[model samples]
Target: MGGLLGVLLVWRVASALFGGGEPGLPSGGGTPASPTPTDDGGNGVPASTVEVAEDFPLPAIGTRLEFKILGLGDDPKRCEAVGLLVGDDQRTAYHHLCGDAEAGTDVYFFLVRIVNHSDAAQPIALASFEMTADGGDTLPALDVETANATREHYFPERIELGPDSRIKKFVAFDGSPPFTPARLTYVDGTQALVIHLRGTWIGA
Candidate 1:
């Protein structure tokens, strides 16, 4: 599992660095050839479904998975100020209190939407997800308490998502300057999902 995640992380980082549509390939119009199957483990998925071209296919927006990631958006700024809703009659602009990015670094607010498609319930632990930086180091999601202090939308430390249900919330991560972020990754045992988010955010 660790080795597989490492390989996919490299591919994701390469895609970000080169701005490619599929790893090293540039974006273009062409009917790509079909993927051929091979003898390889699929992290519980059938081997036939994991083709050579897409050994680890990215989950598209709205696609169903046990715990699917529908979208993500990043708000990268230093001590960024924003308006907040107070009660039902007032809204005020104030410096957010979520958490502070390290000096010389920026804080990234990742708005992530997830869906549970299985028949049983599953736990969505914030620790399962992390932002991988160019330097190969990772930053875990911020604690729920610090994040909730901002009073902005935030995911709890852990929560259960019912089958066929969906949720959306913000997750905070401290950004590493001079070292671009390569991707946001979620891992559950041997199964893994990769979200390429180096130059831009996906979903919304």
Candidate 2:
């Protein structure tokens, strides 16, 4: 379902990418309905409801990226990817994980957060993140591991990057979706979180 050049594009995982009309009414009380969150496409994944102007300028801090964790426990130590759908498929595709086949490394989508430490409006082109499996020594491509620990938006899912920026690509990955990270050594300024995640084993 993905065949783009890879520039600045938006993404999502664990939820449906396409959209259509709302589902029909419950057949006399089937499984209870989940809460319709306001900050999302009304699915489990989170997306931005704010809009950016065309002439918006970049703020002091380039762009702070963040993410939401669902299937994990509260404790950070027990909050890591161990045995879940961490690969690309129909239902549970790891859509956020983007890589350059030409470069020979993969990046994983763990989380995205915005730290507005600016006084004026922080106009960011987009927000993006990356990860590596080789101790930051080399870049690696993600193939849906059993222990992935990141979450992001995608598709009709509504997690927008930018109309043309890669950090938050307005569209999905198409080979040139703006973001071409090297290695995920300094994810948002933190050390190797994926490594810590492996040791913590969230929900283990």
Candidate 3:
């Protein structure tokens, strides 16, 4: 009987530790996990835990942009440019918040939030993204070579966004002193999406 009791206690402990308890039951009555952190931390400043560029502009949250899916014969899907962050510190604590470290002074970080509003999934090719400045300079999306050199985080070659789903990804650009991008363009061979960045700039 003692042996059986000991086994039962062991089972209970294992279940608690391994999430084997009854469904919907709160373990230890603690709070649930929090959602991922966005750029806005409720205050007017950037939500980074590390030092950011002194003059970096913060894009207003909820700015919406639309895109058409080529070959799908569907209506345009909406993508919101949710966040914009730039800093020189490679060891910034915000690294985990967005997924990658900074590249340094020569490389700056740009984050854009893309949300799908269509009924079907939308595939985005990160490699096709381009940043254009008002000075007639066009910067291509970061490639493997650039990413390795900067040690900056980058998006996957392709990402599928389910209907009504959202994803925030980092896009690195080559610029010694960070400047506002005039426009962000994405070409997927069949269709193209152009987002004007004229009024989206907010100084730090």
Candidate 4:
């Protein structure tokens, strides 16, 4: 009985850490491919390498996207109000379930802006947004309820932008340890845009 109880406890802890006990997280799956330049498949979106200062272009849809990390101590009031405020029960539950409690991982937020520079309206499928850790784990953004709370713009599921129009929002991803590199990618069937992330500093 003692041995069986110990085994169950270990399983429970593992389930909490990586087995998708948290809402909006996918269940365990194979590790994702590490972010790297891929050959252009004739879709007009080239595989480009860029620093944080560069804007990744996706001309196939006549739009450009920019991503910026909300660095340490740069917390926004909306982010604080959205249940991610330090010591909030929701955030604590996330850290205990979806995060690496021992390694102090939680969630990190980023600001993303998409601009349509073409002569006509351009449509975007926001569901294609995803982030991959250097460790090869695919981190899904929190569900719309939690993620959209961080900004008035509110991340949308799909949208069409008029010429010279732009939309920006805050997206929250499962956090990693300090300096754990990651990449956020927006890949639809025809075009792909990549944003190289320098890693996050916030911990549980």
Candidate achieving the largest lDDT: 1
* Pairs in steric clash, model 4: 104-204
Instruction: State which candidate has the highest TM-score.
Output: 1
Instruction: Give the least accurate 10-residue stretch of model 2, judged by summed lDDT.
Output: 51-60
Native-vs-model 4 lDDT? 0.40
Worst 10 residues of 4 by lDDT: 51-60
lDDT of 1 by residue, 139-178 (tens): 7876645421433356777888888887766665654343
For candidate 2, give the lDDT of residue 78.
14
For model 2, the superposed segments whose C-alpha errors exceed 4 Å read: 1-109, 123-128, 138-204
Error of 1 at 123 (Å): 0.4
Tens-digit lDDT track for model 3 on 73-148?
A: 0111211122222232111101111112233333333445555656778776766677666674777765533222
Per residue, candidate 2 scores C-alpha lDDT tens digits across 124-161 of 32222223232332332232212222223421222333
Span of 10 residues, lowest total lDDT, candidate 3: 89-98
Where model 3 places Cα greater than 4 Å from the true spot, the runs are: 1-105, 144-153, 176-180, 188-191, 199-204
In candidate 4, what are the lDDT values of residues 92-147, reduced to their tens digit? 11121221233344454444566665677767665666776667666555444432
What do the candidate models score in CA lDDT, each in turn? Answer: 0.42, 0.24, 0.37, 0.40
Give the TM-score (vs. native) of candidate 2: 0.26
